[model samples]
Target: MKLRAYLLMLAVVGIWGCTFVLIKDALSDASPLAFNTVRMTLAFLVLAIAYRRHWREINRHQLIAGVIVGFFLAAGYQFQTAGLAKTTPSKSAFITGLVVVLVPLFSTVKALRPVGARAPRWNAYLGAFLAFAGILLLTVPAGSGVLPDFNAVNSGDLLTFGCSVAFTLHCIALGHTSPRIAFQPLALLQIGFCALFMMISTPILEHPQMRVTPRLILALAIAAVLATAAAFSIQSWAQSILPATHTALILTLEPVFAWITSFLFLGERMGLRPASGAIIILAGIAITELIPQPHVPTSHEA
Candidate 1:
């Protein structure tokens, strides 16, 4: 079961990685808000029909949780899609991977809260630190052979960083809520809320144009079905059983996958620094997953 969950996370990240390029391509003739509004709406419609039976299961708490998570999810996509337009797909992927670091930070803080719980396990902290170092190495620009030029940072990079924060919130919220709610209904509600938010925001914020090309249609369809509905549903179910830290570790592969997709589809190339960073990120994930965890006892235990 654990292995399957890990595999599912990997698959989801792989799809997401490829989307950096696909989304960049699709945005050529389409505004980010309109594109996201349409994709999310389509995803919500499909999930609503397919999971119609689960609608009866939702209650007030689940609806509120759904709204919270859905808002972050939609906002994250907005930042990411808009960023992708102004940045290279590879760079966008690397910046977006910052969530791996943010998740552990949030988890550590929660654990350290004076009233609520004990601190996080030491290994989680170590693994998060390693992942942070790896991301630094992986995202450094190839030509500069130096650390990221922060002074030269563009709007896209800032937006993508915001995307990371929003996604981190989404992941943590899902971890907190998924176990308490029915996964199907929760997933539907979250996506539905995102669609609703985007529907209202798109018209007001975006210029609203779509060329309806075959590429655009394909991107929209794949994004709505596979990426949003199927991937998020898998995430909801997976997080119910897996730790958020573990999920974040696995998701670090997203940038690597993004690099690969960008290479194949967008002719992007990597240098020694980025390559080494990718390897380090994988090692960090392995450290998190392969190491035997110290047990955390439940309240029912003696």
Candidate 2:
């Protein structure tokens, strides 16, 4: 079951990675908030039909959980989509991938003890460090230098950073809620609320605009069906079986996948530095998976 969960998550991240380029292309014909509202609404409709039987099963606990998770999910996408308008697809992906580090930190925070917080395994921290280093390398321009210039950070990067935080919180929330709720109801409700939130915010946040081109329709169909609906359903189920930190470590590969997709489909070229960054990210994931956990003495043994 654990191995299956891992594979499912890998597939989810791969689907999500491909969205970066599609979203970048789609944004050319629609406003960010407007695009998100439509895609999320489409996704919600699909899930609603599939989970129609589960509607009667939703209880107060599920509703509250859905709202909490949906809020973060909506915020994450809003920031990511808007930021993508101003940043390169690769840069936006790498920035959003920072959730790999944020998840562990937020999960283990002392203030979250009341919510069942616990320290992550040592490898989780080490893996996050390496993953973060790889993100830095990936973000630096090809010929810029060994390190990124912090002073040159743009508004788009900042917004994407917000996306990372929001996604980290979404992971944590889903981890806590998924185990207790039926995956079907939970997935449907969260997606429904995400669509609701985005729909409500689009007009207020930005002047909603969309051109009904073939490109827009194609992107929306792929994103809504595959990336949003199927991927999130898989996520809701997988998080029930995987620790949030472990789930996040798997997601660190998203940017690598995004970069490859961009390079292959969009004619973008990756430099040597970014290539090394991709390798380092893989090393980080391997460290967490390959290293054995240290045994702890039980109370009886102690």
The TM-score of candidate 2 is: 0.82
Judge candidate 2 at residue 271 and give its lDDT. Answer: 78
Off by over 4 Å in 2: 1-11, 111-117, 140-148, 235-250, 272-302
Q: What is the lDDT of residue 71 in candidate 1?
A: 90
lDDT by candidate, in order shown:
0.73, 0.75
Residues 1-302 of candidate 2: C-alpha lDDT, one tens digit per residue: 99999998888888778889988998999999999999989989999999899999999999999999888889989998998888777778877766655555565565432254456678767867787777667654534576567666567867877887887777777767766887789888888898999988889999999899998999899899988888766776786688755765676678877887888888887678766775776666556544432211000000
Per-residue error for 242 in candidate 2, Å, reads 8.4
Off by over 4 Å in 1: 1-10, 111-118, 123-148, 237-250, 273-302
Candidate 1 on 197-239: residue-level lDDT in tens?
8887878877888899999999999888988878877776686
Error (Å) of candidate 1 at residue 60 is 2.5
lDDT of the structure predicted as candidate 2: 0.75
Q: Which ten residues in a row have the lowest lDDT in candidate 2?
A: 293-302
Cα RMSD (Å) per model? 5.7, 6.4
